[model samples]
Target: MNKWPVFCLALSAFLVPTAGAAGQDVQAGQILYDKWCAGCHGFDGAGDGYAADYMLPRPRDFTLGIYQIRTTSNGSLPTDEDLVHVIDKGMPGTAMPGWEAKFSSSQINDVAAYIKTFSPFFEREGAPDPLEFGRQPRREGIAEGREFFEQIECFKCHGDAGRGDGPSAPTLQDDLDFPIRAADLTENWNFNGGGSVEDIYRRLRTGMDGSPMPSFSDLIDAQFMTEEQLWHVAQYVHSLSPEEGPTISDVIVARRFEGDLPASPNDSLWNQAEAFYIPMVGQIIADERWFAPSVDGLWVSAAHNDEQLALLIVWHDPSESPDPKWLEWQQSVAASMFPLLDSVGVTPLPDRLTVQFPTSIPTGRDRPYFLMGDARNPVYLWQWSSQGDVVPEATATGLGNVQPRRGESRTLASSAVWHQGEWRLQFGRSLATPDSEAELQFATGELIPIAFYAWDGSNGEQGSQRAVSSWYGIHLEQPTPPSVYLSPVIAMALTVGLGLLVVWRAQRREEG
Candidate 1:
């Protein structure tokens, strides 16, 4: 054998250490649980409290043990480190406060051990304790997963790979130009707290709420993979981080811009869309659905993009300041949508984006469907009623200020740009066509009128002042990926292989 080959193999083995940590004792854990944790998390770890019912997203029910801040794979308990991180940094946007100052490291460890006692799954059976994440030390699977993120076209929304600077991120904001960026995994401190192995695992499994992160448990069938795999992926994503910049960058600077609109703009459709579009409807509709205050006339002043969102819709919420509780809950639910999609390798943008609005709330027993669209001009509003009846006329509402269109995709504005280190984006009429504007406009001039609208980041905080280069629609029917065709085959093969391996090991044990 070549000595060089042998040395290379040995070197690689040295670089990647196998998980060898032992499990902690649950007996000692019970004491800590009783002393410190049982108050918020009941004796049985069921999330119940006088305050629990009022909390928007509710508290973590440890007995159920479905931790949302985990890095473990689907259907696995969080590791010790996961618990420690949560204890250190309190969860944000919630009642969970960082406890690093309140508890000692040893106390935190005891709590983690105690938390594991609540669920049979956390008993570990024979799994690792500290539960290492990633394959190689220092930085595990960072480069590979980074490539995967881009290979799967995650950059289209999550921008700049791990940095969360995707092209479409700006348009995903709500009434406010809140730029939702991709999760910076390297930052062990999360808004929901917890940086330990299990915490990360839970996040990977359940996903963050009110954001676009989705859950992946369904694809994994909840138990397809070993807990170790989940840990590895979490560690891998976590490792893909950018080097730290000055702490000053942590300060979020507010940007506001102003722009002018054209004369024959699509104000009518815009008004109707607003009048009917529910950003946060009741449970009967979507949780984040909301109805616009009025359809009169308003103009887009600015736009922005922060992290992973691409469709920022920052219209004035004169109708009502969104229920803060509802908004918080929505963020947690929404955060999980994209992550879940990522886990299953689903492309963020599906084939076609569809805009659906109710023509009328529903009359007697008839539900009216409205087909809204943009007129021939990139800036004009158009609509069509879909009750299988007569179409309506082009209505004009002098409330919008979209730039005139000559045909083709209209370029919007860009608010902030991060290059090397400098963060800058123009705040004026820079809307011009960029790549990816194929078949952009829609035409339906006569109906109840509910058109879909999204803002490009070129403008800043308000709607864009620049003439839009073009507008894109949301994917109405996301198709199953071709890999879906191979799901049965893959599942069967893995199942059979695992069964055989188990049988072989059992037989060997018996012979011994």
Candidate 2:
């Protein structure tokens, strides 16, 4: 008789308290849920609240007894602790907000108990035991893990480089028949469950319920792979993301270089320049507000010589828009976000990026409106679209007011590449343009205001429906003076001379 099953049963009993537990009051939970959750989850817990239509992934229908985040086995009820954890920390990459600061532990517990009452399955089956997760073994390198990754066909949804642009990525839908996107493995910070290796291991073992992610526990049971081998896969997945999320900065400094700027985005010279991470949010202050935006943020690197300036912008995008493969994805996103509108004639628009600057540099803290500009103060723009290699120069006084500048003033040159779910673009221009009034002149030692707007056309973004960033600054770094480098050598020489003089003086005094 194996004692492991008995041990697990014993542990499960201790992990979850009974429904009739002392701290859990269903009536008290109802009051809290009605006050806090009713707006999105509905009074009947059917996920049809007023705000439900406006959100993607929608709200959880508690009556269905299905959850995406869980510690238990797939197709089983999430443990009470799982519910409490979600309620306290909330789900990332969704509309859910953490309630740890707002609700007491007991209050959260009461709500969790109350949520179970919506489904009859909970009453009949009770809470399920969490899966046994063994200790992680010593890493055997990502090579073996990469092999396992391919064997399991993770690339079918997560892509070869884990940017979520795989062949099946555009077609994925949740169990509820709502369009869904696969996780971008390179951005673990946005993982709904958590980003740690242990969290990844658990997700692999138990799988995410109410989603296409399925458990691999059967592989272990069938002796195809051992528990230790699965941990390697988790470690490999964990290695895909950065050690920490990118930090936001107020300014991007352009490094001074000796020669011409990097010829293309792939130039190794660009690596010498530090990359700045800029976060973006949907344009919501004006009409036709965008609630969901595909492009979340971008990485920027800048460099300049005496005559010219260059910028390399890198961002993750699942698809190169206008690609026939993503046509269905474009339609699905449009229909889901705007069900009342007709999407029959809709065609995929090209992806675009715009670099924004005030037509005239701001003299003070005051600047034009972030959404393009106001009539009184127009803004200059370097607009790059996927449809063409040319980067057109434009000016805008407001959201809809844009004038493209043609002929001699259009000196902006650009190169772009989309590979493995990422876009790398390099834009080059002269430091000083012929038409200073209509264009931005890059100068050293000055803080030039900068902003960005991105359009992921596959997500139905166009016109005012795009991702935008608040005003930031770019400073062209001044060249290092030769005197500053010589100062260190001068100090060392003086120190040695002073020590020699002191030794001589001491020897002369001893001789006397």
What's the CA error at residue 453 for candidate 1, in Å? 24
Which residues of candidate 1, in runs, are more than 4 Å off?
Answer: 1-44, 53-57, 68-73, 79-95, 113-117, 120-146, 152-242, 245-512
Candidate 2 error regions (>4 Å): 1-22, 389-391, 481-512
Model 1 lDDT on a 0 to 1 scale: 0.36
lDDT: worst 10-residue window of model 2: 494-503
TM-score on alpha carbons, each prediction? 0.32, 0.88
Worst 10 residues of 1 by lDDT: 248-257
Cα error of candidate 1 at position 314, Å: 13
Query: Candidate 2: deviation at residue 179, Å?
Result: 0.8
Q: Residue by residue across 459-478, what tens digits does model 2's lDDT show?
A: 77888988888777776767
lDDT at position 27, candidate 1: 51
Q: Report the C-alpha lDDT of model 1 over 1-512, residue by residue, as the tens digit.
A: 66999899989766632222344444555666676656666677876644343233445677665654555544455556766777677685355767789777766665677676566775544223432333333435545545544554556655553434455443444212233444444345433545554555556556553445555444345665444444555565655432431121101111111232211222222232211111211111112221111111112211212211112222221112112322332343333322243232111211111122222222222212111223322222321111112111122222232222233433432233224111222222222224223212211111111233322112111121111111111111113344653344333233223322332344356425
**Alpha-carbon error at 67 in model 2, in Å?**
0.8
